[model samples]
Target: MSFGLVNVPVRLFSATENHDVQFRQVHEKDGGRIKYQRICSIDGEEVPYSDIAKGYEAADGQMVILSDEDLGSLPTRTTKEISIEKFVPSEQIDPLLFDKSYYLEPDKTGLKPYVLLRDALEKADRMALVTVSVRSRMTLAVLRVREGVIVLQTLLWADEVRKPEFESLSEETHATQKELAMASSLVDSLSGDYEPDEFEDDYAEAVAKLVETKIEGGDITETPEAKGEESEVVDLLAALQRSVDKAKAAKAGGASSSGASEAAQAAGGSDSGSDGGSDGGASDESDAGKARKTAARKAPAKKSATKKAATKTAAKTTAKTAAKKSTTKKAATKKAS
Candidate 1:
């Protein structure tokens, strides 16, 4: 890696590894592995991997065949060294732009300089914005310290990250200070230092266990599906308050109650109208159903009140019109006499 006037000879190693279970595609009848061949569309002949060349299809339906020689002559050839451009505050870079990461180890000759750079970065809380050519493509990358080792992480180009165009996100929304306080309390209740060791990849472990079971002549049974939470458009303030209370209760005595109970308490009288429905006898009505029922009850009352007021106003108008007509008729009769 190039660092100003000093060059640090370093080796790059992948920072992460996948631990997913692997599967093979095979013929059901004979258990033979399924294989594919590369065939040319024009000639209908199978082509060997050695004869394959990269091809790009144009907008006008023309194929552009690129040979090894043509590709090699391109400007974006791999550079052996990582060139540091500048250093910037690490917080300024968005984590969303981070792509792939590699651990950089220094050669014996460059050990001192490597330690110096790493210590400087950690001390200053900055990342070195660098450019590195990898896989025949020049890409922008950053060098930062991770667990005392310098890590080089590639970044996506500005255009690669898309701008979200969600309608709900564009719409104006507001929340009361009370709701915010409750949400903040909930967050505080659950806040802790993130330790990666505290979590495990359950899916991977389950897959490995399943394969082991099959290998041991065990019968494979379907895993029980977890109960899904009912979709709800809950009152934000009520939900936050419930969450905060639950967290506090859990912290107090390690005793906890079901979320359903909390949701029911939060809903209060919202479920009253639900009894009139066809599923009124159903005790397992969702919180969303309760909210809907509450809205239904309120809407009819508002409509009925409006209608009654309108009817009374109409009756008064009719009586006033009749009285005015009688007075006008009497005045005309007296004038004529």
Candidate 2:
């Protein structure tokens, strides 16, 4: 809080926290919750919290016990003050060095200086380098403006940053220009502007979704379960080829299914039309059969009328012959008288 004659009374706030899903150990046989107790290794006994003291073991196997009173009496670099040494461009700090962050809220008395410092840092686009002791350990930190508030970000020490000592990378490796160009082209094709909001904690989301699903479905696991899996070695190039082929096959399968569905629907329409035509043809044949039956029923009546007319004509001719013979016999009788 004391930086170059500018003092600001501020309260510290943790900037980040873990949101990972957590699990606890449990007894497998009886489904009981398991508890851990701190036991003294040398004495082979359980120790109470009041009897436990912070101890540091030296290489010579000597344990140095430090009580809370001893730690309180120790001298520290800061007298409850955040000391800002200098200001530097923000880019000079490596992201790897960043450890933790805290937001500083100004007290009622120190509001003006906090605003002044916040405005100055924002205008200059720089981060204030500072040193603060935390948890009995002093570390490097930076002060910057975030959301109109001052944020203190702790940094790791140079010795804390481990050196890369991988044997695989220790040997020199070379690539052809063509390979480099192809890799660059791949990167270019896939390059996009970063948006932090678009990314999410997939594992946490999946866990939440699973819990929600189980709650809604009224499903709960009673005991721990064991699962099995399988793995195999495959050529990298062949795997890529298979992936591409699989994607293409899936796309083609989807298209083919759509086409088949359409064809089925069309065939159904055609079948309906064909069934209607068959019904119509059956109805026409029924009408034609009725007409033929009517014509056959009238033929017998017409034949009976023709036979009756022939009989009448024969009777008329016989009567005319009898009349002519009677007239000839009367004339002959007159001639003999």
Candidate 3:
């Protein structure tokens, strides 16, 4: 079904599902069947479904029972259509606003319409804010295309999210200006385009594989390892500097690898055109040649930097120890004299 001004063709389907193993109620001792009881809160009495009534307790333990007809009498806008209200930049919506995702498929004849809508959305880089009724519940949703398929994600209302007060958090002044600058530089150096494939549900995959192993009659065991948790840094500046340095190193490694790969490709192409007889040798030679040159140029600079840093650190430590020893000796001499 197509909807709204954008003509988004959406066939609603759930995006997520529960994968947990389900268990039924049973007796603990003999493993017999167990039954659940619906009891009245005020009295210690069991109630049958027929006798149960919905009630709201007011002051002084006063109660009012609401009938099915009475509940239905309440005013509500019940429209089954996923009505899109407006289009907005996807970035404008806070991630906390999203609740659940659903796959949306176009009707058989709605393919062209669907593509048009998808392309339009992709071009504008916006998501459609939609209101939809599902299973007697009204939901606010954001609609977008994922891999050429329309996806509708249910959203939580603004009031549903809790706001954090900045004042409640501890205010600690730390991190030197130099550290902050270095950290920023590192972040910039390592920054790259986001590829969703780069992230994976490792925990989910591990759990699935473990389940498979258990099903195949493999024994499961747990290994305990000492957990080393670092204390929260009060020094923000120092932490930032360390982060920057780490980012820079990672970026340098990535750049070097990319350069080596490009060089290898160029060499391979050149060697391939020259003679088909030595293709295998050519490819290997090209790869090795690039690797050697990259290592020769980059490794020495890295090693030199490390050596200088180590030297400086050792000198500083030695000076500090010597100063402490001299202070102690001066105190002893003064007392003896």
Between candidates 1 and 3, name the one with more favorable lDDT: 1
RMSD for each model, in Å, please?
A: 33.6, 30.9, 33.7
Candidate 2 overall lDDT versus native:
0.69
Q: Which lDDT values do the candidates have, in the order given?
A: 0.71, 0.69, 0.66
In angstroms, how far off is 196's CA in candidate 2? 1.5
Candidate 3, number of clashes: 3
The number of clashing residue pairs in each candidate reads: 0, 1, 3
Task: Give the CA lDDT, 0 to 100, for residue 219 in model 2.
Answer: 79
Q: 1-337 in candidate 1: lDDT tens per residue?
A: 9888999999999999888778878666555557677888999999988898899999999999998899878898567889999999989999999999999999999999999999999999999999999997999999999999999999999999999899998878888999999999999999999999999999889988888889688654444322233324345556889999887655432211222233334244323333323232232234344433333333334445434343334333433343344345445556665
Best by lDDT: 1
Model 3: ten consecutive residues of lowest lDDT: 223-232
Instruction: Show where candidate 3 strays beyond 4 Å.
Output: 1-9, 20-28, 32-35, 57-64, 170-337
Q: TM-score for every candidate vs. truth?
A: 0.60, 0.58, 0.51
